[model samples]
Target: MRIAVTSASGKLGASIIKHLIKKIGNQNIVGIARTPEKANHLGVEIRQGDYNNRHDFDKALQGIDAVLLVSGMDDPQKRIQQHRNVIAAAEQNGVKKIVYTSIVGNDSETAFSPVVKSNRQTEKDVQEYGMQWVIGRNGIYIEPDLEYIENYVKEGGIRNCAGDGKCAYTSREELGYAYAQMLLDEGNNGQIYNLVGEAISQAELAALINQVYHTNLTYEAVSVEVYEKERKEALGDFLGTIIAGIYEGINIGANDVHSDFAKAAGRAHKTPLEMVQEIKAQE
Candidate 1:
């Protein structure tokens, strides 16, 4: 079956394409990107697709049997319509199935709520589009913490509003594996899977990082206001607030949800320790 992955230049999209290639062969996969040239190295047909442009997606999705819609990174309000553009185009082109990469979070508790609400709207849209659909509510990605290892070391530990709450984290590679199955397996149609790994607290995550990197990092809990202020100072208003809001959600146990990764991928999700080890080996 021919499958298309949107936002192909992105890390998540690229990873999904990698797994899809192994399952369906590169000849049957298409990478759609806002800048097709950036994704040419993926070694598949690259088509121009911008979430904001329905005309471009109309052409990008042509002759495709299914498509993966990577959530857009625009203003939450704008993302709704942007995602609609792709869905509308997909339907117009007679795509048989569509999958979406969504996230799991409370819909009204944090600055990140708007983003979650927007994803929900798209989820509803995909379900009602009269085509087969699968939605994966992705857990918080663990790569950022690994990428910021140096900063954590400099700060002497991990500090956030998560307190003792556990977060279900998943890696891009794992998500890619699950998404490939979701796109290819008919059993996954009409399902909304929570693609998450084992849930762990910040302390547990820090310990896992220590095991991999041999650091003496500790987890420190702070108030939501304090953490939000700090993140805002470090990352500027928009991003910092969102990051802080995510932690705040964690603080309230919004991220500690049931996982359906095994059902989605046909295998258990990798442990946090395993993920850390894999990334370390790559480094």
Candidate 2:
């Protein structure tokens, strides 16, 4: 079965491609990305393209049986439209199935309460299509927090407003492996798997980093306003908005949740403590 993966340059995308190569062999995989030069070393049939480009879509979908559509990381306003383009191309090209990596609990307006509306619409569009579908509604990747933890522990100051609000963070590498497994299995069609691992708070994460570094990493809880200002000063305004948006998302219980990545993998996913330990060992 030939499978095509979009956004092949990203961490998740690259990991998915690697997993597919291991499971199905390199000959059956296609990696589609906006920049093919960056993905050249992936050693798959590289389709240089973007979601909005119809010509690239036609070329990428040729002779492909299934597709793993990683959500585009462009403008939020254009996200759904880009998905529509991919779904339309898949339908027209007669691709048998599509496994979409969607946001967690995107089906509920209250879950993506702030962003659910668009993701829900995209899910509907996929379901409406004739192709068989499996939705991988994934949670946030904890691996991104490596830098966050490094910043906090290196300076001995951890700042936040989240007090013991547990969050389930999955490793993108493992999550990619799970997605490739579903694409290979063919039994998971029409199923929506909530891909997540252990739940831990920012304070717990700071403690883990401190334990690994053999230093005292302090924690501080500030008002949302102060956190936003500090984050803006440290990071740029755009990234500051995103950081504040995530904390807000956590506060509103958008991400303080859990799911069954264990069942999906038929085993327990890496825990927060385990992940931190792994980072420590690597360091």
Candidate 3:
């Protein structure tokens, strides 16, 4: 089966492309993105197309049997429309199956979770198209912590508003592997998989970071506003604001906890402790 992965420039998308190349051979794979130049190293047939362009998608899906639609990173509003275009094009082109990388608990109205709502709308569109699809409801990735881990170690503490709420953050690589497996193996069509990993609280994460650096570690539960201030000082206004928004959503249970990931992959996922150890061992 010919497989095409959208958003080939992204970390997770690139990983999935690589995995597909190994599973089905490079020649049978296709990579689609707005900027095909960025994905030149993918070693697959690159199709240049924007999510908004239905014409481009028609050409891209010519011989593709399945598509892994990596949700766009643009504004949530635009992403919803773009997803609709892809769904329409896929139906017109007769793509057999589709796998969407969506977010967990997207059907509910949670705190500041625009992606959740947007994904829900897109999922509905896919279902309406009468296509065989699998939704991988991936949780927050643990790799984002790499930016703050050193600072947390240096300050000997980390502050967040999640309090004692637990979160099951998945590794991007693991998620990519799971998506590859899903594409290769059938029987999961129409199933929604909530991908989660080891559960870890902010305090537990602090302890793990401390152990990694052999330093004293602590977690300070603070309000969203206060954390925003600190994050802005460290990460600048724009990015800091975005991170603060995500964490604020976490505090209110938008991303608090879940365990359905193991069910999707049919096995246990990675844990925070293991991730911390790996990070420490790296230079």
Candidate 1 runs further than 4 Å off: none
Q: Which digits, one per residue and each the tens of the lDDT, describe model 1 over residues 210-277?
A: 98999999999999999999999999999999999899898888899999999999999999999999
| Model 3, runs deviating above 4 Å | 105-111, 154-156, 213-215, 229-241, 278-283
Winner by TM-score: 1
> TM-score for every candidate vs. truth?
0.99, 0.90, 0.89
Q: What is the C-alpha local distance difference test score of each model?
A: 0.95, 0.76, 0.79
Off by over 4 Å in 2: 105-116, 280-283
lDDT of 3 at 4: 88
Which prediction has the highest lDDT against the true structure?
1
Ranking by lDDT: 1, 3, 2
lDDT winner between candidates 2 and 3 = 3
Candidate 2, overall lDDT? 0.76
Q: How many backbone clashes does candidate 3 have?
A: 0
